[model samples]
Target: MVIVLSAGKLILTPTELLCRLSSGATLRALPDDIRLVTTPPLLIADAGAVSWTLPLDGVECLDDITEFYGFAKE
Candidate 1:
């Protein structure tokens, strides 16, 4: 599944971590979720109970994703 975090539609903070998955909607998460997972190439984010491995290996949205999650560009 694909996640998109631009505005504050989704919430992922010290107190809360949320991800509402839809059939064909945008999936969003916080920076901390990914940081605790790994690096840029391996796009991973935790949704409390489970971890999501995004299938964006060579997509242009990677830049946007990195910026969105405050990931260090590699």
Candidate 2:
């Protein structure tokens, strides 16, 4: 999935979202009324208004780097 973390905003793909959950990221289920069986990150969808503050340390952001360097000059 393509996830862009530019300007402190999270633009994630459906597949990426699932990846985070599987990786054990924390999710905050705001608003009461939501029913969830597991508190693990994988079960975030079950919780209503799922929220998480994930660190994009290893995650790559294409916007931060150039895809092709010195291609035009070559």
Candidate 3:
């Protein structure tokens, strides 16, 4: 889990991600459910059948998330 007071929570499991990003929305996804791509300041993720751009702080924190989910890091 990555939790920052200025940001929010990002919980990663072998098969899932429970994320409440800095955008103030609670979200969830499973591995392979959709692609998760991290830009410098945003996480492009999927919610249900739709996709959302979730704001995330700190590149290091974002890196942890992508790595855990088996996505290639930049």
Residue range 51-74, candidate 1, lDDT tens digits: 666544344446645555556654
Clashing pairs in 2: none
Candidate scoring better on TM-score of 1 and 2: 1
How big is the positional error of residue 24 in model 3, measured in Å on the Cα after superposition?
7.5
Task: Report lDDT (CA) for all predictions.
Answer: 0.49, 0.28, 0.65
Model 3: residues with Cα > 4 Å off, grouped in runs? 21-25, 33-39
lDDT tens digits by residue: candidate 3, 34-70: 4544556566666666776656666776667666776
Candidate 1: list runs displaced more than 4 Å: 1-22, 25-28, 35-42, 57-59
For model 1, name the residue pairs that clash: 3-27, 4-27
Ranking by TM-score: 3, 1, 2
TM-score leader: 3
As a whole number from 0 to 100, the lDDT of residue 52 in candidate 2 is: 39
- Residues forming the 10-long window of minimal summed lDDT in candidate 2: 65-74
